[model samples]
Target: MRKIIIGVMGPGERAREDHVRNAFELGRLIAQEGWVTLTGGRNAGVMEAASLGAKEAGGLTLGILPTRDRNLISVAVDIPIITDMGSARNNINALTSDLIIACGLGTGTASEVALALKANTPVILLTENEEGKRFFKALKPKLVFIAKEPSEAIQMAKEILSP
Candidate 1:
């Protein structure tokens, strides 16, 4: 069977503590379930945190880098795709993963969420932003799910990925 890939999308530089913390737990849990954790693959913010969490849990991690800068790569990233596709790589992040969990909303994350929904990929939004929640939920009511916590998001992911 193919391994499930869980894309953890969030802010790279503007990620807050909650976003980082939740992304860590999400990555760890995803790894615990033998799923792959996919992220932007930078050494900062949510991407770094989630990758670290998955690596610590003995899970695989795939980094979809927007740039070719090897120095920007995260130490936790085992498989670096080195896209150099810039923001356009967001589409790859959204479409390639089996499911997407938006740990925190940002300009890039918003676009990724939309792309995922457009492709009918199940997305669980874990954000404290009411405006963002309202906006995304409005796009695809059936495909969008609002998660208040990382654990809850994982539970929802289970339901979505299960046969």
Candidate 2:
């Protein structure tokens, strides 16, 4: 069977500690389930925290970077794909993953969620922001899911990934 690539999307520099911690535990759970973790290759906020969590659990990580400089890749990223596509890289993040886990809301995270929905990729939202809730309500139920905790999110992802 092919490897499952689980994408994690969330706020970067603007992420809150609670959201970051959620992403961290989510990543750890994903790793423990023997799935690969994917994130935006940035050193701040949820991106950094999730990568660290996955790495600490001995899981593989893939970073889809928006820059050309390899040295700028997140320290926790095991494989870095430099797109230099700026925010357009969000489309790549949505398309490449089998499913996406959104930890928090931000302009970037919102965009990634929309892109994933457009691409028919399933998305699990961990945070219950107004914008996310509104978007979730508007979308089809099969494509969007909301989880109150990391374990719940992991279980949802596993259910969606399973045949």
Error of 1 at 137 (Å): 0.9
Q: Please, what are the lDDT tens digits per residue for candidate 1 over residues 1-163?
A: 8999999999888899999999999999999989999999999899999999999899999999999999999999999999998999999999999999998888999999999998999899998989999988888999999988988998999998889
The C-alpha lDDT values of all candidates are: 0.93, 0.89
- lDDT for position 38 in model 2: 96
Best by TM-score: 1
What value does the lDDT take at residue 26 in candidate 2? 77
List runs of model 2 lying over 4 Å from the truth. none
Please give, for residues 38-140, the per-residue lDDT of candidate 2 as tens digits.
9998887899889999999999999999989877778999998989989999999999999999988788998999899999999988886977767674785
Model 2 C-alpha RMSD to native: 1.1
Candidate 2 positional error at 110, Å: 0.5
